[model samples]
Target: MAEVKQDQVPQTVGFLEVILTGPRMSGFAGPAWPRTCTIYVAIADEVVAWQTLPFESDSDDFKKWRLGIRVPVASNWPDLSLDIFVERADFLFRRRTNMVVVTREGPHTSGHTAVISRARLRLLDALVLGDMDDEEEEKTMKRRRSEVMEGNPRLLEGTVPFGKAVKLQDWELPAPGDEHGSPRAVVRGRVDVRMNLRPAAFFG
Candidate 1:
């Protein structure tokens, strides 16, 4: 875990933790004959703040690997999180190719969507010691029509609702344990997000 301060925060943050589920890969696996996976979390976009939790292989605590990411409420959007399983490890070792697969066998394929519930946020704040003071948080502005139009040719070519509010849903994945008491399978959860939408822009 890395410490982040308000003023000198890096543009991007990374988290390395054991993949309790998903696929097997090099450099991250449990002690039991290589039955798990490893994952990395990388986040950008300063306007929206995000956080992720690495899954723990030995604990029965379901909340250990959950994440909480904050988006501007002015956008009329909910806070969100994502659960990812590292199903495969792509390795380039001395010109040889090796890959490891980690998966959960059941009705759910180790992946599901999620909405960042209030409970989830509280749990995340405690885990990461996140500071959410109004004064400290940063807000981002909406992109100019020119910029949006320039970048997305489709928008200019068609009658797209550039500022429409899109409803987001929640998802979840599967987490399975092995005989040796290690988490060998994982599930995922996610929320839909419409970036850069502001309340004032939509209303007045």
Candidate 2:
């Protein structure tokens, strides 16, 4: 990979080709689960693209899906970790709890209202590009970043207990569950994804 010049803005950029294939469920098997799946891609905390796949069809070709996304070259390439999430169609925020607790003081009473909103992610993958100049430094930096991102310092305690933690950067949730560690009514399917990087100016 060639290093992009900082002073020059290229007329064209590179395209990140993502091929998601062979998604199958192991423990979950049923028709109640939505046959359609949604894919969300996020880079630098911003959602880049969203795609949906209709996997319920009996056709074999529908099992695989491909996406071509354009990405601009910038100095933050090393910090640009691409995150992908695959979820069922029914995946959305569910209100678990909503209540108000009243506390009385000497002369005044205050009520604290709390609301819980949650969602489940079927599969998640994070891809980080390494520095072409220094491989060792890139590895070290990745490890440190992984450690810091995985640490749950702001986790709260409530009706939803924390489940087994996984690495945020490079990890997959096969059967995503609620905050209480209980799996949702979604089917489980194995997803295979292949990513190919190419310059936008190239056509092959």
Candidate 3:
């Protein structure tokens, strides 16, 4: 893991990509879905980070998800982490002639992992919200809801909890011209942090 100096922190407008994996139910059997997700850059003390919207039918093709976060230059911010959750519902069935039946399938075990950034840590009094400007909050809320209802139930929401400090492992760089062009001299790794999914008060 690379350690960054407090004075040398980069501006918070760079791109961040996140990868998510696990199993999901198909028409019958379950299968593995790997997805690559992206996020537009924004500044926040700590906000939700997801590979993509949770409800899309085609979301399984991605191997990772990208989140765009804007880190404040002057604020003291701690290293970053992730939170995840999954949603499930029950159903009822009818028998052949005149009988009715009901059944419940899940309470599915939704796995949560926190991706921790190994960069230098800063202690901030309060994290800043992203620039909303002319964007209405309702529009953003609708977009987020659509993602959750689409069947893909992995949702990255909630604030990060404090715990034992973890060290980020080193990741091998991709070959030249693979996707990021020639491999630059940058170190990369992610820490998977566990999260609780129950609803809490929103303090915005």
Candidate 4:
């Protein structure tokens, strides 16, 4: 498992620990496998966390790999649900050759959705653990939106490319074990969120 910690912090900040494991490639019948996989974590449909995992073709080393990412949760966070998305970065779809089949029954088929991406959102618990009234919510929303926009102007300009991301509700609880690449298999993962209330020394 890979872990990272924040060092420069005099401000009050919470931590969201996300564990991604048991990634599998299913329903893909192509001769060439995906070269990489990217995971996106979202809150209220806005991306808050993104992690890319590059496949090591040598020895098929990524079959049992596990990734751990930490996201900082600040005060006045918006009230929303937590969502996760996984995309096959190197999925080959646009090709004249019938090299891949979408279904197992078919031998050779083309024109399959080239980019295979799946998503699952865990809404069993309220993502916004903080309590705030309408006025506070409005202030917090504006403040957070400003922060986000300041960090990435493209988001505010609506220049980022987005898709109709899919979300799976039942797959929140994945099956145990090392079934990373099973057909329609959900990745085994969990999220640990902790809240902090210390005062901020300086705004980043």
- Clash counts for all predictions: 25, 4, 24, 3
TM-score of each: 0.19, 0.40, 0.22, 0.36
lDDT tens string, model 1, 144-192? 4344446643222211211111121223333454434542222233222
Clashing residue pairs, candidate 2?
A: 24-189, 24-190, 25-188, 25-189
Off by over 4 Å in 2: 1-14, 30-33, 91-188, 199-204
State the local distance difference test value for candidate 3: 0.30
Q: Model 3 Cα RMSD, Å?
A: 18.7
The superposed Cα distance between candidate 3 and the true structure at residue 123, in angstroms, equals 14
lDDT for each candidate structure: 0.27, 0.40, 0.30, 0.41
Better of 1 and 4 by lDDT: 4
Instruction: Give per-residue lDDT, candidate 3, residue 63.
Output: 32
Give me the candidate number with maximum lDDT: 4
Tens digit of per-residue lDDT, candidate 3, span 1-204: 998998796544222223333323233322221122122112243444434323343453423433333222221223443323322222233456554333323222223222211222222211112212245743654454455456323322321222122233223457756886553333222223222221212111
Which of the predicted structures, 1 or 2, would earn the higher TM-score when compared with the native? 2
Q: What's the C-alpha lDDT at position 39 in model 3?
A: 23
The digit string of per-residue lDDT tens for model 2 on 48-150 reads 8876644454555454454556565443343455565554433223356553333332112123321111122221222332222257645654664454467
Tell me, by TM-score, which candidate is best.
2
